[model samples]
Target: MKLVRPLPAYLVQRYHGWKATTFAENKSWYRRLAEDGQHPRAMVISCCDSRVHVTSIFGADQGEFFIHRNIANLVPPYRPDGDYHGTSAAVEYAVTSLKVAHLVVLGHSGCGGVRGCFDMCSGHAPELEEETSFIGRWMELLRPGYERTAGCEGTEQRLRALEQQAVIISLENLLTFPFVRAAVEEESLTLHGLWNDIGSGGLEQYDPESDDFLPI
Candidate 1:
């Protein structure tokens, strides 16, 4: 039952090339990070899309950001029922232990997970609606957002709205954590919502004051 496999030849060679070039050039920096331990200034929770590059987007170095990638960048509500919560665990560590100053929930355009959820909720993707489907269960978190966006006239508009809703919902759920709420209220931590347009190469930030995603 070996579910995992080794890297292919091409990827292995590419990794070694990167190690020689990038790692070799930053050997001292990497060593220092290992020795001192990581103290990232921000915690980024983004989608598992290969196109959404957080490091490149922020021009951040290795030890600058603690990132967590999950489907649709969705954050479930605070449920302390002794279940395995991977995203919650990361949020707990980043907020409580790492004391990251900023917690960013990054969503993006052309997200397959979002599209799948949209289809599932709309009765188009019956497979995802099954109880045995992990994606369907995980996507339940976005159902509220779907409700809001489902009224849109066009399919494209609905999907895009749902993408932004994912960011908004995640930001709301982040506050459900007591530590997260306390940190924000005391000014130790700030929460940010960002949506990236994959095709247009544009970044829009959610503004609580105006309740809109304004371009940055």
Candidate 2:
């Protein structure tokens, strides 16, 4: 609590600018959203990378998508051990309460989290091997993905494959939740995996039939 500080001056300035322009133009829309509550059609679990603009990428408006961001966009397997699980909580709320129709796990190219996992699993990042490293523990969730892509021919190829695997792994984990599985089984909800190339703005979606990420 003692370490807490006020918002940065630059961010405050930016907020004021937005309030004057965007808020001013969309005042009624914002008011309606506030009064009606959110009814997002989809839940997007994406990487915490600043460059990955989920709203801009999909051209979605406010209240259109329930977004949850985390390192590597990972979703841990369902374990009702009474432990604190932020991502799991969000998924539960989105699926049970919000009743979102689609759940999307979005991964991206050149993800630092994936690189850290790659390095850690490759035995290069000893620091992440330490038990006290929160990042190390978090990145452990993606270790299986690293194993899947370990035999790729080059660094770039392996990294890209691993990135996509992160999405696949998360999609698989989502099914471990009984509610999510029930929703999917009832055909009321669907799961999707996507990988974005931040530099080129290209998007690829997972095709379960082909077992590949095809460009969209």
Candidate 3:
């Protein structure tokens, strides 16, 4: 705790400004949320990238969506081995405890994590090849996605394909969880995969029947 410092002056100033305006205006809503507890309709698994604003994108209110963020929005296959599984824990809580109706795996263009996975899988990033590299280990989850796009011709095309594949991979992995599978089977939960074009602010949703992402 000694290593921790006070909040940056700029952030503190911004917080005070928000407290004077946004928080004051929404004080009643905030109090109601505190009293009633959260009951978000959907759970969004998105990347830790700062540019990808989940709430802003969806125009969501404070408790409209339960969100979990990670390196690449990746969800590992279910393995209840009693290890530290942060993502799995969140998934379990969202599904079993919160009973969210929709679970979305959202990917975006120009994702650094996806790019790192591509470089690592292509043998271009030697530093990531190190056994001790945390990012490398995490990116391993996307190796299958890289393989799926290996046949893609151009780098741009391949990268885009891999990015979309990341969402698809996560959606597929979500089903490996017994709870997730059961919920889906009972028609209590639904899974969705989405890819966003950061520059254009366009969205594409995965279509199971066509096996492609259709513009949304």
Q: How would you encode candidate 3's per-residue C-alpha lDDT over 110-195 as one tens digit per residue?
A: 99999999999889998998999999999999999898897999999999999999999999999999999999999999999999
Candidate RMSDs in order: 1.2, 0.9, 0.7
Q: Whose TM-score is higher: candidate 1's or candidate 3's?
A: 3
Error of 2 at 32 (Å): 0.9
Q: Note the clash tally of each candidate.
A: 0, 0, 0
lDDT of each: 0.95, 0.97, 0.96
- Superposed by TM-score, candidate 2 places the C-alpha of residue 51 at a distance from the truth, in angstroms, of 0.5
lDDT of 1 by residue, 140-176 (tens): 8999999988578899999999999999999999999
Q: For candidate 1, give the lDDT of residue 152.
A: 87
Regions of model 3 farther than 4 Å from truth: none
Please report, as a residue range, the 10-residue window in candidate 1 with the lowest summed lDDT.
Answer: 148-157
lDDT of 2 by residue, 1-216 (tens): 989999999999999999999999999999999999999999999999999999999999999999999999999999999999999999999999999999999999999999999999999999999999988999999999898886899999999999999999999999999999999999999999999999898999999999999999
Candidate topping TM-score:
3
- Where is model 3 poorest over a 10-residue stretch in terms of lDDT? 142-151
